[model samples]
Target: MFKIVKKWREQGTIERARGTGLENKKTTNNEDATLIQHLRAHPFTTATAAAQITNFPASRRTAQRRIRQISDFRCRVAAIKPFLTQQNKENRMGYAMQYLIFDQNFWENVIFTDEKVFQSSRNGKIRDFVLDSMKHILNKTIAVVDFPLMCGPGLVVGVPDCVGELMVD
Candidate 1:
């Protein structure tokens, strides 16, 4: 039964297989933090179970090494306590109160406002930074940022030197 479980661990059916050290292998794109988080919450029954969590082919020895790596980081346990503390849940209203303390009229006089946004149709600010979305969307999407160049005289009203601003949160 042990050997059979070990074989399953090696095959990747079980990601957290103990003794394989496969999970220790540095991933280029790290697994979601939730994976590590799950392990902390539940100790697995078999090496096969450990192997299953890793999503990598792992043998008993590989699983052991990976478990060691995970264990080594357990020192971070102290930090998690504070991070998850109810104190963290305390009201963040100090900032909100301070904001209220300020005169609203002063802000109205300044004429600046902040906002958040998503993909745009006639409205603005998109940077694919991944691709030049401008040519594709053109006036239709408003992606490549400063396009429709809000600067030229043809534009009307309180717009700035740059194109329409896209507020993001």
Candidate 2:
């Protein structure tokens, strides 16, 4: 408290002075910028991987600290999102236009169902530094449903043994 009052009386402001703390001994400004650039290009790169790939002379802990110092990046769990191509978009538009004339009564007879595959044994606690949460990362794999198969009459769902390979029952 006495030191705080003394500094306040001396500087006429309570705000701390810039560049008063200890300097970084492991990495320099240019190296930090290079690390940041590498992370921006490949957000999934782990701290150790980034250090190795960027040829950072410091340890993995220093590299991690550098990443944490940057305000624009954040480590978060990736979200699942379906990726659509141009051909897929066109097909969807055509389907929508074809069904545009259908009335509410006609639509009432239709049933929509969605299926998602969950890996019970897989650990999904992976975290990556990303600039935007809206953009999908490569960590989460997305399998697109081409067309629904008809089994009996009630509802048919397609099961995938592997990605892009669907089996119907």
For residues 116-167, write the lDDT of model 1, one tens digit per residue: 2334332232222111122222222321111112232111123333333222
- Global CA lDDT computed for model 2: 0.61
Off by over 4 Å in 2: 1-21, 80-125, 132-143, 146-169
| Model 1 lDDT, residue 101, Cα | 57
What is the number of residue pairs that collide in model 1?
29
Cα miss at 50, model 1 (Å)?
2.0
* Index of the highest-lDDT prediction: 2
lDDT of model 2 at residue 39?
A: 76
Q: List TM-scores for all candidates, in order.
A: 0.22, 0.44
Model 2, range 1-169, lDDT digits (tens) per residue?
9989998899888776766665546778888888899877666556677788888989988888888886467767656656768897567556545655879886564544434455431334455667655455444333333333243112223233342311111
What's the alpha carbon RMSD for model 1? 19.5
Best model number under TM-score: 2
User: Model 1 Cα displacement at 132 (Å)?
Assistant: 51
Q: How badly does each model clash, as a count of residue pairs?
A: 29, 0
Model 1 TM-score relative to the real fold: 0.22
